[model samples]
Target: MNITVKLFATFRAGRFDIESRTYAEGTTVGDVVRELNLSEKELGIMLVNSRHVKLDHRLEEGDTLSLFPLLGGG
Candidate 1:
């Protein structure tokens, strides 16, 4: 299946703001995270097709996944 991933804030540094990636069936959000070389601790909010989802959530074809890092500023 193919999904679009959107990275926000510092997550976009050295990476793309948005990109389309292909995954096998039954792929979970965590699988995508790992493929992106991102740790679970670096994940703040996750959304699949505009709905909040857990790392274990399964992805569907044509779904858009958005990942945000935990933000902090003085």
Candidate 2:
């Protein structure tokens, strides 16, 4: 299945802003994050097709997944 991933905030530092990639069947959002060498503790928000979802959320073909890091400011 193909999923469009969007990285936001600090998450984009060593990654891409957006990219469409293929994954094996039964892959979860957390799987993608880990594959990218990201830390779960840094995750802020997750969205699939514009709807909020958890790390365990299953991704489908043509689905767009967005990831954002926890916001921080002084």
By lDDT, who's the top model here? 2
Q: CA lDDT of each candidate?
A: 0.93, 0.94
Score candidate 1 by TM-score against the native.
Answer: 0.92
lDDT of 2: 0.94
Off by over 4 Å in 1: 72-74
Candidate 1 lDDT over residue span 1-74, tens digit each: 99999999888888899999999999999998898888788789999999999999999999999999986668
Q: Using Cα atoms with residue i matched to residue i, what is each candidate's TM-score against the true structure?
A: 0.92, 0.94
lDDT of 2 by residue, 1-74 (tens): 99999999888998899999999988999999999998999889999999999999999989999999987768
- Error in Å for residue 28 of model 1: 0.5
Which residue segments of model 2 deviate by more than 4 Å?
none
Instruction: Provide C-alpha RMSD values for all models, in order.
Output: 1.1, 0.9
